[model samples]
Target: MNYLCLAGPTASGKTAASLAIAQALAERGRPVEIVSVDSALVYRGMDIGTAKPGAAERAAVPHHLIDIIEPSEAYSAARFVGDAERLIAEIGARGALPLLVGGTMLYFKALFEGLDAMPAADRAVRAALEAQCERDGLHALYRELQRVDPVTAKRLQPGDQQRIQRALEVYRVSGQPISSFHTEKPARELPPLISLEPADRAWLHQRIEARFHQMLEDGLVDEVRRLEARGDLDADMPSMRCVGYRQTWEALVEDDLSELPERGIAATRQLAKRQITWLRGMPQRQVIACDAPDALARAVECALRLVA
Candidate 1:
């Protein structure tokens, strides 16, 4: 069975390109289904900020693994891999090509390259770390991490409490540095991959800024407000930790609405930078310029060639 993985940074036109490829293939009497590879898109009520395909779009082309979980719950790369593997099999059984599309490079990596062997999350250790963070602040834990695993500490930001806690938890559970577990491991077999990005960095940045403002205009704050009013979600949840949602949640809580757009855009750009860095390390992917006028046509051609 042939598979197509379309990956790129957020707002790089991966969805439209994938939809076009699916449509073109359908015209050729070949059915294609999209299995979203995005982490943020999995949460319910995270529509606008996640850039989830609208109802009309989803109706036009089938999508899987989206809106499969509530915001109050946690979803992990392991869960994503399990869901994607099952979906791939189902799509294959139906004789349709499976197209994995999104900006979540970690999910793509876990799906294709497999994950590191790591211990499960120890709730007791995590709670202890959380308590330590609340009492002594995140910097103290970061300092402790520096003493134990300087490599991971240097790589993570001092304010990254979630990761800092996890790294510490890993150490507490396994008596080994988390970084050591990141060494190369056996991987699952995958099909052809096409990575898309704008050739002009400036253009992509502009698009990021513009799209953020557009999201604001499209009621992103209101969406966050609705999520907050639900009383079941909180800022610390993984779903709420998404780039724009996090900034917007803080802005709403701190009553600093004016800085919301700027902060959200900045955070999104940082996310894109990290995503691009990951994409750069992926081997054997056909990279395409998403900003090209004929990008969709080029993508369809690439998909056809891959499956042929």
Candidate 2:
């Protein structure tokens, strides 16, 4: 199968670049479809925060793996691998090249190297630990994690609530460290994948800030309002905990846009830094350094070379 994956840090102009490549392939009479590699974009009514493609852009080329689930359901990288592989195969069956695009590194990892079984959520233990978190504070629970799953705890930021809760839940159910379950063997597969990185960090940061401001101008607040109105802000909803969505929710509750947008921008910048680190680690894929205007051309050149 001829599959092309476009991955980079959040706010790295990856969306536009990937779309451009897909359009270029289409222009060359190659049947192509975009399958989102994003975790957040899978949830419905999460358009602005996830930066999901608008109706016009999607109509221009078929997009898949988006808006496939409600916010209340949690999805894992293993599930994403299953769904994405199925979609890619169906697209390939129809003689179309599948262009995989997004920033979820775990999804890419799972797709490439497969995941071992992890403990499922133990609601009883989760409820007890979550209650403990509410009463004793998240730090107390995180400290508890540090005692048992020290390695995983070290990897997580102290303030990371989701992962902390998950680790605690794992200990409760499996009677073992969550870190033990994370197993990957050194295996290799040749995928028709092309990745792009911007040469200048300063330039990419500016683009990140500009794109976030544009999202606000495009009614991100209203989008959040609509999702909130639909009860998507409820704690059980997975989309509520997305990075951007969480910040916006804080803004909504505080009614403070004065500093929230800048906070959002800063968070996005940090995320982009992590993405750059991820890209640097993936040594096998074809890499192209990009500027805005020439990014598409460079990526297309790489893709054609790979598929040749």
Candidate 3:
């Protein structure tokens, strides 16, 4: 199916650009709907930390793939591919442009092209990794993952024992970084992709820090606490493992809320780094400097051309 994609790091103006592009399309008497590519935005109670579109924004433009699931459940690229394909066709059938937007590059890759067939889980290796984790702690395993698979390491939170152990298991089983498997997928027709990236890393880092702090001010810790009160979620869940949620959860557990700001900001910056890495890998995408004064206009122009 033909569609348009706008991707970038967290806090890179992707959401703002999507809203602008949709509004621009509306002004031209063309209908448009945003299909979120973010993995985190799927959860119901994850509004503040995910920076999900507010009621007014969702009222302005139709949004899909958001608030479709609960925090206790996991969302995968395979599931995203199926859901997105259906959404794209439905939106097009309704005479609206299917505009995909978010920093979840894996979902974008899976939707436009295809996902890599990752290796099967080695139970013995996983058990050993679990034993190691139990004995030495998640930090030890996370460090080993950093040594063997830095790309995957950058993508996972240090407290994310589930993915950290899984990365190590894959490395031990295949003797290669999990990142390599993603590159092995055959190239195919991708949607016209517009990437919102900052020209200066520092600019993006500053925004990451500022936005995370803003989440706290908007009740990020309380948000995590409410989720924790659910008693069904933990740091191991993919939802809790999100940048801000995991860091805040840990801080609350450790009885040190003061550390939440630093931890959350640092984790978010790391997430941005991995996102930039993913965007650079897509050589065919159009790049707009998200830190530029005209970034929104530039992104809107490119998106309009794609859908025109």
Candidate 4:
């Protein structure tokens, strides 16, 4: 296994299990470096809300692709694939294992399944589309996408602004249906995937709630305030749209910290649910019940066995 992946829903113990796996590999004289698959972790100064690996943990084990961008910037699946490929090669050249870890399933999908040679994003075209959306509503643009590229439209919701706009932009820019470009993508080798999930839903929910409250106790609100004070980021940015950050930003916008706990916890649970759904769609993943007493040990064994 040239590449090993450890993925799970939020608060499902993925971080602890990944650290243990890396340590176990190191003890066996096989160094492993983690490459974050998370979109949120790529941004700097968004730590507490992201449950990012602490300074000590990162110092203990080399981590890649974290804090690589500013909150005002955008990180896409294509960019992630490019960065991960480079890091995986470099890490392997150093004779260490590259462990892909995080809850960003779309990155994993793009890396393992291969991204189609779609047209690069055209900012000018996209801006025009955004203006049109503002004037005519998202439904009007979605309807236009349906007319231009129904195959892509069928897979998207009427309100999926990013994808809807992209599909339209592709057609308008390249005179081709975006879906037509996906007809013949070269397949990629599927990496060994280990997924940590809980057997008890309520147990996972409790963990999510507890962790959100702990993030608050750890000054996540202060973190958000600092980011907001920077004046360059907003709620619509990908960084602020993160589960915890989004809820905290809304609370701050409303000047109401009291409702943050409920809103943040609820949003985190919803994120976990979406992650689990994505994990289930990947048939190659090996599942481990994360709430088990021996989960970490089992995860280490599984990882070591795969990387051996």
Candidate 5:
């Protein structure tokens, strides 16, 4: 199926732009569906932090693959690839265009460039990795990854604990360097691809700060409070480790922060910076410099040209 992927750094207006594009397509009487590519958005009760669309917006356009998992569960790129393919096929069967959207670079990359053939996730291995992480430190495991899969290690930052653990876990389960299995192929054989990006970092930084503040006002703290109240405080869980959520959890439990919103905003800004760094690595993407209002039109024009 032909898919249009709208991806960029956090606060780059991907969500709003994708919605607008879907609206435009609907106006043109074309079939369309928005499939989330966000890792954080998959979790239930993560709306405020993940910036999920509200009920009204979702009612206006069909959205898929959202709120299907709990914060305590693990979600991976491979699983996303499988689920996304299935969803896209189902959407296609219904005569709709699947518009992929979010700032999850790895998800987009995994969809386009196929992942390495690694063993299935072994819970025991993951448990062992977690234990190793606490006993030896994430840095030690990262260094071990460098020895085992230097290519992946080189691409990953030292503080990227999740990825470090994942690579190590793959090696442990399969007894092969995850790097050795890193073959670059399309996750799904499909039509031509179009990737949209932000053209300016300065403007995006402003948007990032503004968005975080808006999220707080929109009940991000309350969302975290609810999640915490549900007894899902396991920091090792991916959702708890989400950028804004994790930092908020930290401030709420460990640090006695009177200004919780401020703390959450700070952490979000840092995450946006890392997201910008990730986007910069994709130099080949068709980037447009503009805010949310302008992004959808730019993306639509680009998509029309690519698919023309």
Candidate 6:
């Protein structure tokens, strides 16, 4: 059975494009269901910042792998792969195509190329590292990583606390650098992929800025405030560490909301850059200009041609 993988940078119109593809397929009597491939969209109460499909959209189309976990709980690529595999099979059984959509390139990579056998996350060690980060700051932990795992540390920014923590945790737990575990391995072969990206970088960046401000107007701050009020979630958690959420959380704590929009937009642009880099490396993907006037029609045509 054929499947669809819709990938793109943040605010590049992957969601709308996927919906259009699914709608077109449905009109052709080949019903399709969307399976979210995003890491942040899996968490509840992170609606605005994550750009989750609203209720009207959900009611119009079937979606899975969204809002399946809480903000405090951890979700991994392995879990996403499992859930996606199951959903794919179920959708196929129902004679509908599965359309995987989002910007989480890591999850897509894991789903296509099997994950490496890295050490399991040790909560105790992770907690220790988190506590150390809180005490000595992320730079201290990054410097420590540089000392122990210079290869990994060199690739990651010092302010990237989540990755730095995970790399350090792997080293402390298994006595091996995380990079060494990234050896090539056989994985499940994915179906046709449609990658959406803007033809103009400036257009994409402007879209990112506009979307972030729209998110703020749509109550992104209030959403984060609600999560903070829960008392269990924090900036250290994977869910809260999401690009926009992290900046907003810091703004809230620092009592300086003035530059939140700018920071969020910058971080989102960086994220888009990383995603575009990853997509460039992917094989068998049809890249489309997401800002085109006929983008939706183009996406539907590409998806149909691929699956055909």
Model 4 lowest lDDT segment of ten:
182-191
Model 6, range 145-191, lDDT digits (tens) per residue? 99988999999978777789999999999998899898867555657
lDDT of 5 by residue, 1-308 (tens): 36777776777667677777777777777768889988998998798888888898788888988999888888989999999989888888888888888878788777776776677777678878989999989989999998888999998989988778889988888788777776656345544434444555567667767887888788777788888899845666778878888877877776565676576666766667666666666645667665545666787777666544
lDDT string, candidate 3, 113-166, tens digits = 787777776757877886788899999998998999999999888977767888
Q: Count the backbone clashes (under 3 Å) in each candidate.
A: 0, 0, 0, 0, 1, 0
Segments in model 3 whose C-alpha atoms lie over 4 Å from true places: 117-164, 170-186
Question: If scored against the real structure, what TM-score would every candidate get?
Answer: 0.90, 0.88, 0.85, 0.87, 0.84, 0.92
Candidates 1 and 2 compared: the better one by TM-score is 1
lDDT of 4 by residue, 189-237 (tens): 7889999999999999999999999999999999999999999987767
Q: For model 2, state the Cα shift of residue 149 in Å.
A: 1.6
Evaluated at residue 219, the lDDT of candidate 2 is 87
Return model 5's CA RMSD, one decimal: 3.2
Best-first order by lDDT: 4, 6, 1, 3, 2, 5
Model 2 residue 64 lDDT score: 93
**What's model 4's lDDT at 163?**
72
List ranges where model 1 is wrong by over 4 Å: 122-142, 151-162, 173-175
lDDT against the true structure, each candidate = 0.89, 0.81, 0.87, 0.91, 0.77, 0.90
RMSD of each: 2.5, 2.6, 4.1, 2.9, 3.2, 2.2
Report the Cα lDDT for residue 273, model 3: 82
Say which prediction, candidate 3 or candidate 4, comes out ahead on lDDT. 4
